[model samples]
Target: MEERVWTGWNPRLTTVFSVAKTSTSLQALEAELNSSIACEIEYASVYFFMPETCKKNIPVLVKTASTPYLVVYKSGIPVLNTPILCDTLTDNGDWIVIQRRTSGDVDFFKEWVH
Candidate 1:
């Protein structure tokens, strides 16, 4: 796997509050993430507030390794369900890793159904 180093948060980008908790298992983390008010970005490993809520695009740090990411929700805040957990950046959470894919492991031409 190719390691992508995180240089730090950009000053111009909108801040993303860390709402993730430390999870003991992948299932637990998935459940937490799905219930939080966040969305996954394509290049970054961290979750950020949804575009509709934030009203702007927020850039996050990238992590290339396979890891579990945590999620937490404030009381009374609406929870949104996001089932898929594919990330392309390094995460800083304490959860079990369920699946990992190295470079060239995915077949782009193959039809995948989950």
Candidate 2:
């Protein structure tokens, strides 16, 4: 698999916040994200949401990487795919995920993006 590097806080939730894919409103997304931070799921870094919510509601911020990178985040999950893919995100330097190109699916980090 290929790799992409994000400098800093590549908020995956924020990146897709523009399209509003959640059953709840923007305020809800905000609340969900904020509340989830303390109540994170077993092995998940981010909660899952619909595509519309991700593209229309989340807000991505520009930050810096603490170290060099060879991967990016896949909606709070890490990826090891191509750098040109927009759906992929990157945090400090711990994990990586790969974006699915054909299906345009973002949920493959756990199943196939390895």
Candidate 3:
């Protein structure tokens, strides 16, 4: 699959698309991402030290500016919205931005990626 999709722990929650799969539509991509997020959330509390719902309520401050938080990312998303991902550094307090590298990045889809 040319589409680079990964769901696992690499210091933080990460899911990325290595290459776009023309065969898959955007809807399909979102579904796949949701699956990844869901799987990670199920086990995230143990590593994040917060409950599934509690994670979002707590706004963390990261000096590094790049903290991978899957549970929190998913929480902010609405039940029905095409997820947007952007690979860049953003200065939004309590809100995180992601860079596009593919293999090792935290919350690569925290914002719209282009």
Candidate 1 wrong stretches, greater than 4 Å:
1-66, 75-114
lDDT of 1 by residue, 1-114 (tens): 123223244422324322222333666878778766344443123334312121112232332234433222221225644333322224532222245567886865665672
Q: How many residue pairs clash in each candidate?
A: 2, 27, 8
Stronger candidate by lDDT (2 vs 3): 3
Error of 2 at 100 (Å): 55
TM-score of each: 0.14, 0.15, 0.21
- lDDT by residue (tens digit), candidate 3, 1-114: 333333234323322332344445776989999999998985674435532222233443321345334333334456823223322224423333444566774554576655
Instruction: Indicate the TM-score of model 2.
Output: 0.15
lDDT of each: 0.35, 0.40, 0.44
Among these predictions, the greatest lDDT belongs to: 3
Which candidate tops TM-score?
3
